[model samples]
Target: MLSTSMRPLTAHLCLALAGGAFTCGARAQQDPDGTAVLDSVVVRSTKQERTLLQTAASIDLVDGQAVERQGLQSLADVAQQLPNVYFTDFTGSTPTLSLRGLGFSDDESDSLSTSVLIDGVPVYGNALGTLFDLDRIEVLRGPQSTLYGQNSMGGLVSLRTRDPGLQWGGSAQFDYGSGNRRRASAAFDMPLGERTGLRLSLGSEDADGHVDNRALGRSDTAGWSSRFARLKLLHTDGAGGEWRLGLHHARREGGNDFFVSTAQAHAHESAASDAGRSDTDYTLLTGEYQRALRGGQRLAITLGATEAHWNYWMPLSQYGGPSGFDSRTRQFSAEARLSSASAPVGGLDWMAGAYASRMDKSAPYLFEVPGYMRSETTARVRGATAAVFGELGWRLAERWRLAGALRLEQDRRRMDWASDQSGYFDSDGDGVPDTPYTSADRIDGLRVRDSEWLPRLTLEWTPAAEQFAWLTLARGYKASGFNLYAYTPSSAATPYAPEYGNHVEAGWRMRGAGNRWDLGATVFHTRLRDQQVVVIGAGGASLVSNAGRSHSEGVELNAALRPTAGLELRGCAGWVRAQYDDYVKGGEDFAGRQFPNTPRHSFGLALNWKPADGWETGVSVRRVGSSALYPDSTVTNAAYTLVDAHVSFRAGRWTLGLYGKNLGDAKYLVRALDARTVVAGAPRTLGVRASVDF
Candidate 1:
């Protein structure tokens, strides 16, 4: 846990940093004839179009231009700029994501507490492959179950891709960095006809990673390569109707893990006996149709299908042989919605929608110990969900508005698992293998069903133009599931219960005159019941269980200032206290313990400067506070800070830039299983990039 005495100090330090940026901006001389105005940001995460200030939710927006300028390559990079958001990158099929201290931290590929959506469609498996050619990214904090449904018990990450334009144009970019890292991407947009257009995007990235493996005689133990392509076709009927179809495919191959024993001489050095590798392929297809209706109403429908396949082999023990896992997942989803127009009709605005989805997954697990033991497990799971949701907003007065939303959802899952093993056993309990045993076990037709009613209510007051305050109450839920890697019938037959949360938040946002400055603050609290947690079962197997009660409370602040022309400053800070309220496991009480993998304090500051017409420069700083790494242990990850900067110059249709990350070369842990083995963060990196437009 964070020291109580240090909490106030951390808050003060973050405030001081933000104040310094604001002070610098204020002191700069303003041009007599030119003035800077902040651009208005629009979001569609709510299934409705609204400005950031007008939306009654705790939200963060990252512009696509900022992504390009800062060289934000992955979701982890984007999380640096948002308050109360964290991403944990591991050498597994999926990374863990958390918002405001609530998240899924296990290796289960079918479950998510914070869901990711691409253009309003939920994406299963790895979402990292869809991070390019984006128009914008929106992070909606807190429960969004009323609109997003299950798996969104924490929040939602919405990535909107660029649309096909009517004009014919194209752009290409290339980047070269330290560790022999290389990246190339290109995009083209063209008009197919007077009312139709087509767009295509392609990208590839590869790098010789930083870790060194002595046993394998390899310097790129964690290196990886990936390629992706996307295509979209759009048509307008000129009668208030439109249609769009999209296809995306991505593939990745390489080493995924670099675990070094703490006894090793260097942090970036590993001594594993077996080389671990991972390969993945993902493909998605989507179709959308929208039509304007009479009486200020509109109808929209969306259909999506996705397939993902992943295979990996990793070393489980320091000296033992490697283990392998193979998974293939496919899902189909459809949704239809009818919404009132932007303009109010009869002092009311409303929306109603229905959603349905089906997913099928098959995963095979293998454990091998060269000459000692071997085990294999085959598992298959099928899940289906359906939901109906509606929201209504009513203006009580000229300055006050009230809104309510509700969603009824049902989820069902079925699993079939079988395991076979042959190994030496010590039946006499003399610490020696006296018997050779071969056994087979099967658990078939195991099923789980869950239903939940999620609701949200809000009250908003427009105290004045460009200023807003709101209070909200919401309920969140996560569906139940069985352990996919269970090696025994007992663990395979057990299913975890659904997790639920009640949340309350109050927030305020304001914009200065001419949009020269803006600030937003929010305070929130959430209480959870039946929190799902991973624990060590009999024989050292991992299992998911409905643990105990918990709560998370936090305060977040964000500010942006354009004190002078050609210079802008932005800062965000968050403080959270998340702890178990009543948790006991294996005859030990863990109540009041802080949640694992959740930071106590987070802060970020960024400044962008464009002194001349063809020149641009920017610098950003991020700080994360210390926290425990596991629920059953006191081991903690110390606080760390990182600095990144970039500078670029544009000449007509061509541009060149230089960027650096982790300039301080800080050594930190991205993941750790124990004191002996750990995964280290990236070292210092510098890169140059060039781009051309045609």
Candidate 2:
């Protein structure tokens, strides 16, 4: 458990920060001028297209240009810069997100509490695709359950890919970096006919491992390779309608890089002698249709299907044993909505929609102890959900607007699993299980269902053009599920209850200096009831349980400046005080303690320079504060900082870039065991890239 003694120190730091905030609020920073102005940013992540200044929720947009300059190859990299958000590890391919310090979970030890969308289509499980030919990514930092339904209590991420333009064009790029890393990407787009166009994109990366395996005397243990391919088609019938169809596939294969004990201070070393491997494959199909109406109304429809497979083997040198699993998931989803910026009735802006989805997950695995025993098991879980949602916005009075949204959903799940083989038991009660216990049986199946109603209300006041302030109240929800990792008869067959949260937030956004300067700040609090929490039970099994209640409060600030043309500055900071109001496990009460693996403070700063003659350069740095992991199962991580820099030359779509990251190769833990095993961050890396258009 995290020490309560640190609370006083944290409270003092927050007090000092509050004082500094008041001092800075007196003067608004200069907005980025020319093409770098931030107020003009438009996002469609909410299923409602709106300008940044007009939205009340917390959202951040990361464009492709910024992504390339920062060399952000994974979801974790982009998440680190956003306020009040963090990813669990650098565990390649798969990313686990925790937003607003809502880091509680009760299902898989590593499943996400949030939801991700690609082109308006919902995607579940590991997000393992390359971010090539991507247009932008919008991150909404509050509960999105009113629109996205379950699995989004934490937040939502929306990704948009570049579409096929009217004209024909193509581009390609190659990059080489430290650790013998190599990457290549290419894209081509062209008109197929009078009203049809198609686009294709592909990318691949291969690199040597960063961690050295001391037991095997090798540094090749954690090596990895990735490939991604996508095809999209666009059509316009010229009758106020448009359609898009897309197909995408991604594959990743790599050495397992979880963790091992290391003696070096700043270096990561593994003790595994076998150097096990992990492989993942993902495929998705998407279709979207939109039609414009006469009264500023529109009809939108989306359909999608996806499949993901994960295969891995772990040879824990410390355990003197090996474990492996093969798991797969298939899902299908559909959504339809009727929306209008100017409704015929009352002329109020509104949207109404229905969403439905189904998913199936299965896993087969084996666990073995060198010369002792082995446990083999099979697990299956199937689920379906249906929801109806709507949102409305109306002008209440002069310079005042009110918005409301509601969502009602029903979720159902069925669990059918069995196992063979068991372990020792404590029949003698001599401080240990002295008697042996064996089993070759199946447990009764389980069927569960849950329902929730999530709602939101927002009141906005625009005292002047280009400036607004708003207050919002919202609720978030997540569905119930059964534990699938157990081989014993403990908590596997039982279903956990759904979790819910009530959130209140207030914020203000302003853009001045002719839109060259942008600034914003927000204060939020969330009260979570029946929080689903997980614990590692005997034999490394995960058990799902509920916590009585918890609450989190935080403050966030963001600013962008273009004091002069060709120069831009950006920064963001967040501070959170999150703790359990009431929590009990195994007769142990842990109230008033911070949740594991949730950071208390995070900050970032960046500078982008664009001089004449097509020359560009930028520098960015970030600091992440300490947090505990695995409740009492792991130790806490200390605060750490990282820095990255890049420079590039561009002329008529041709560009050459150089980048360096983690300049100090900061010593920090990416993950840790409540006890000894620890995994450190990757060391410093330098790379160069070149690309062209035709």
What TM-score would candidate 1 get against the native? 0.92
- Residue-by-residue lDDT tens digits, candidate 1, 446-481: 888988888889998898988889999999888887
List candidate 1 segments past 4 Å from native: 1-40, 45-47, 125-130, 149-151, 263-266, 315-319, 342-346, 428-430, 630-633
| lDDT digits (tens) for residues 1-694 of candidate 2 | 1011100001001111111111112221223343455535566523365677777777766765556555667666666567776655434555655677664342252224567777777765354535667777777777785554334777877777778877798899888888777889889998998888999999898887587777788877787798999999999988868899999888888887545553542566676776776788888898989888776777888899988887777656535565667889888999888877643323477888889989888866677654455677777888898999888888767678788888888988887778787566667767664667677857656778888888989887888888889899999777887766666655666667787889999999887765567788999998988777765554445567777899888988987776777776777788888878988776667798887767788777777777766787777777878877543334667787777778889888889988887776877665554345655666787899898999
In model 2, what is the error at residue 576, expressed in angstroms?
A: 1.4
> In model 2, where is the ten-residue run with the lowest total lDDT?
6-15
Candidate 2 lDDT (Cα, whole model)? 0.69
Q: Each model's TM-score, in the order given?
A: 0.92, 0.91
Q: Candidate 2: which stretches are off by over 4 Å?
A: 1-35, 39-41, 45-47, 103-112, 149-151, 262-265, 316-318, 343-347, 424-436, 538-540, 631-634
In candidate 1, the residue pairs with backbone N, CA or C atoms under 3 Å apart (3 or more residues apart, or in different chains) clash, namely none
Measured by lDDT, the strongest candidate is 1
